[model samples]
Target: MNGSQALSITDRKADEQAMIAAHNCAVARSFHSYFNQYILTDHERGYIVIDEGDYGALPQHLMDRVVDAVPSKMIDEH
Candidate 1:
């Protein structure tokens, strides 16, 4: 999504759900982070699609990543 159309997290460092998207630990950037951000909308509930997380995939793989998160500011509604 473009910057203007993209969602905003007022508190980038908020404690709701924090999965670092970048680091120097040599992790691949090919994976996606905060997927719930795409599924969540204002005044809506957001959750992980697969509770088990990354079925059949090896741990730490890109498909293995699942984040049940919305913007930090939106977390208060829950």
Candidate 2:
């Protein structure tokens, strides 16, 4: 690949790693107990609700990855 393209890939990887670290930190801090629950709902058009009261507005592609990575479920009763 070209130099610019390779650099872009590297930069994207770094950004993704940073985001994952941040998400882990946030999840750990919010859930005090041993078991933590997270929910994903459409907040805006591109954003999603992560662990009630916390929202992350990521790109559509990134949103898909986040959804896949996190354990999410719907509460029909609520």
Candidate 3:
């Protein structure tokens, strides 16, 4: 890769790492319980997951906020 392309990849990786850290910190402070927070991205799609196990385990307000933040197409049906 060219120098510019290499730099771009480095910058993107740094940005993604920052995003992951921020999301994990937010989930920890906001949820007040154990949960897995993931920010996944690929060629086709990107999405965030705040999994608190079963669907019923997730708070409605938090779920609503998550849904509102993410695009419908990014969310997996099942």
Candidate 4:
């Protein structure tokens, strides 16, 4: 609603579910999800997708590193 007027990426439980499904689909087939990607939508702002990597290869120690690298969460607050 401000600046670029794009919607926000308010991630959801379904997003997590889709991630699981995609992961399962990938593993059951050929190390790749049948969908290869899933999206998060904000009707006003738009959408975002997740469809990369092999099962989100996250190591225990790297959790903080990855979390730290994500963009700001206050995008829609203003």
Instruction: Provide TM-scores for the models.
Output: 0.17, 0.34, 0.33, 0.28
- Greater lDDT among 3 and 4 belongs to 3
- What is candidate 2's TM-score against the reference? 0.34
| lDDT string, candidate 4, 1-78, tens digits | 668664345465555555555444434443233333333333453333344343464445433322112222222333
User: In model 2, which regions exceed 4 Å deviation?
Assistant: 1-7, 33-78
Model 4 ranges with Cα > 4 A deviation: 1-11, 31-78
Question: Over 4 Å off in model 1, which ranges?
Answer: 5-45, 58-65, 68-78
User: Model 3 residue 60 lDDT?
Assistant: 59
Lowest lDDT 10-residue stretch of candidate 4: 65-74
- Residues 10-76, candidate 3, lDDT per residue (tens digit)? 7778767766665655455444434344333333333345544335455655555453122122233
**Model 3 quality (TM-score):** 0.33
- Clash pairs, candidate 4, are 7-45, 26-32, 26-33
Whole-model Cα lDDT of every candidate shown, in order: 0.30, 0.45, 0.46, 0.39
In terms of lDDT, model 4 sits at: 0.39
The true-versus-predicted C-alpha distance at residue 33 of model 2, in Å, is 10
Worst 10 residues of 3 by lDDT: 67-76
Task: Give the per-residue Cα lDDT of candidate 2 at 31.
Answer: 47
